[model samples]
Target: MPGREARPAVEAQLLLASCKGGGPMQKRFLFFLALLLIVSLGLLAACGQPTPEVIKETVVVKETVVVEKKPVKLVMSFVPSGDTQQIITGGEAIERLLEEKTGYEIDTNVATSYAAVVEAMGAGNADIGWLNTFGYILAHEKYGVEVILATVRFGRPYYTGQIIVRADSGIKTLEDLKGKTMCWVDPLSTSGYVIPRVMLQAAGIDPDKDFAKTVEAGSHNNVVIAVYNGDCDAGATYVDARRTVEKDLPDVMEKVAVIAESPQIPNDTVSVRKDLPPEVVETIKKALLEIAQTEEGKEALKQVYEIEDLVEVDDSFYDGFRATLDAAGVNIEELAK
Candidate 1:
């Protein structure tokens, strides 16, 4: 500790004796060798056991162990305009299950419009999303969104849109509403707007130019309300929205009746951000696939999404939607832009 104070007299005497027996050249070599040995032993004795090298190695190992313990956060975005409470309830259940299964915390964001979900995906606001068929089509075309799962209602991968009217109203069919007021849900909604619009166009009626009044009610529930309250002669909305109405607002259910049913349209799909890591995407796909198999999950999903299950399907299901729009001569590119 005090710098090897005055080398011990005994050690000095021994070193001198060893040097005395050698010629001048040998003495110099012996002196240097003795000095080297003394310095090495002093360093070893001062460092205690396991040396500085061992301590540095232990620190490096501990640092690596700490780095390996970080957790992953996965964020999901879903539609949130109606029965938000039910939506959050179902979403959190799935979030908790996903966290348990994958060991990653689940974070969720609710988008007011289907188009807004697309925007969230594009802006990197969410790692996964629930998007309507119309938004799915637009996202695939413009944002390259990756569809990993499809929600099925009543054990089918597709659902329908029913153009409805007050049962007492004179409107009986698509043609009967030619000069009547009509309400539309979101523009990027498959059953709410796109499919219904396509069906109307097929019957030689132009909703924009021929209707007496065209109003946007923003959501499927709003469209139902508009028609039920006589705010519009007819309204376009997804069939599941009618279920929500029957269960939540029975008063409206008794007032409206479906006069026209659009052809089956694919239900919403869960899409992943294109840039998400492959493993994370796989984990999401697995979690979604499991949701339909469990009892509580099935019930929660049915209440919020009316989804009996989630099925794996390829991108081809949406190709028909594109074909339908193309047949109508509608420019989706312009709409998404």
Candidate 2:
């Protein structure tokens, strides 16, 4: 009985040890299963959530730039009709006035001859011209130069050419000019050469052969001075050109006498190049018209060409003069050639 009891006790002891070992194994299994469950739940939650969207911010920088502009420059040319120095001074005054009126830079030039001014306009070297009547006509025919204004003198729109001689020279008629030295302003001069030549021809005197000597004095003032100084026996010029030298020679009016006077000739013109911008042409025309009404403008004009005022006119204004030239057998194209 003792041996049986002892066997039973040993068996019980082994069973107790088995139970204690089994308890630790069961706890480890439960802990591993719970960790796997937690990992699976976190993955499921991550799969249910939306993907994050990245936002980008952009910044723009602005820069400012500036450019400078230059003013427009216009060249105005003139024919030397009187004292070159006086004409230059007057031209500069006009330049200043126009610059103030138009806000454009103005440059002034006095050409050596009328044709030079016309050619400068045609060549685009000049934008404006103060042209004599015949010079304007020639420029219009050749380069389509346009006349915007005609000069007024003593309230008259027309002037006459006079053939001058010393008061005691006894050259009373155009016939007396034959076999005498003759002075002319220029071949292109309207009153100084063209009309006077026509007068000589009408008198049945040949200008080419009748004169003992011919001189081109280059300007109206020079022609008057030449006649007064006895360098020329007779000369042609604009009516009363002697007054130009009256200050220097007080006896100029007394010494120089008018032998004959031509018919009415249209006054000189303020003309522009053909290719000039229409707006610019209008501005120039308006400025000149306004300037003529000013006292300062009047004095400057007097110094330039003895201009009394400026009157607006068109090409038709010269038609009468053209007809006269045609009737006299004077061919403008031929003269141009």
Candidate 3:
């Protein structure tokens, strides 16, 4: 056929042209043309084929963070009205209950004397104080300590001070106490010293000069023990304080007799420093009231200060007691100084 004859003729022409000794430039041009043609064919073949699939991978990372918080802390101080160790144990129990209720860390301590407790509240070292009547008065006047609660005993918000003496001492009357040795709880003690002193003055006897020797027994329990042991001819304490020692001294009630009882004195107080936060004070008051209702709290209160219950009170609660002190010529300002 004509097509087959034309293809052989073109091949014969190309072979003859290549066999001829062409110039170097002409041969280079021919070689480039051949390469260009081959590349074009390759591109056409590639375009005709299907395209390949491509995949991309991604990596993820995560981060975590944590935070820590610290608890609020408070300081509570107690007046050593009875045994020091026993008071401390009770105070600790109260601290735990308060901490659990309020979610605040509480530290408790019993001061060596009533004045120490007052001073601690004044100096901002103690946030809470268990203060006696006279001590509370002094603290309130000088430092503006605020009373939040009053302790109850024998179902009474008020308690009386007693002038106690051994049954065999023959000290049947306040006048008979003259020229006799006397044991006092502490200078700042309300029932054991202050009110009893007022009682003595009303009877025409001076506590400082009438007694041949006066001893500060440091605690009501100590005063009771001192009188029972005859360390002093007579002593003063809270009414019926002899029962505190009845566990150890079974004959304390028989050996020590109450010769006299002072007029009604306000019970001890649960006071707070003047600068304490009002919210904190309220929290403490609420926590204590709740704690007092529990059996554990009742036992703790009994151990700390023979407290039967706690009742809310204010600065006015001590007004009658203050008037009695005023009439008795006891100056609060002077005592504070």
Top candidate by TM-score: 2
Q: lDDT by residue for model 2 over 146-250, one digit each (tens)?
A: 999999998998999999999999889899888999999988899999999999999999999999999999999999999999999999999889998899999
Query: Sorted by TM-score, highest first, which candidate order results?
Result: 2, 3, 1
As for candidate 1, its clashing pairs are none
The local distance difference test score of each candidate is 0.79, 0.90, 0.90
By TM-score, the better pick of 1 and 2 is: 2
Tell me the lDDT of candidate 2: 0.90
Give the poorly placed runs of model 2, Cα more than 4 Å off.
1-70
Candidate 1 lands at a TM-score of 0.77
Question: What is the C-alpha lDDT profile of model 1 across 81-130, one tens digit per residue?
Answer: 45666778887887877787788987976677777888888888878888
Q: Can you tell me which runs of candidate 1 are displaced by over 4 Å?
A: 1-65, 251-254
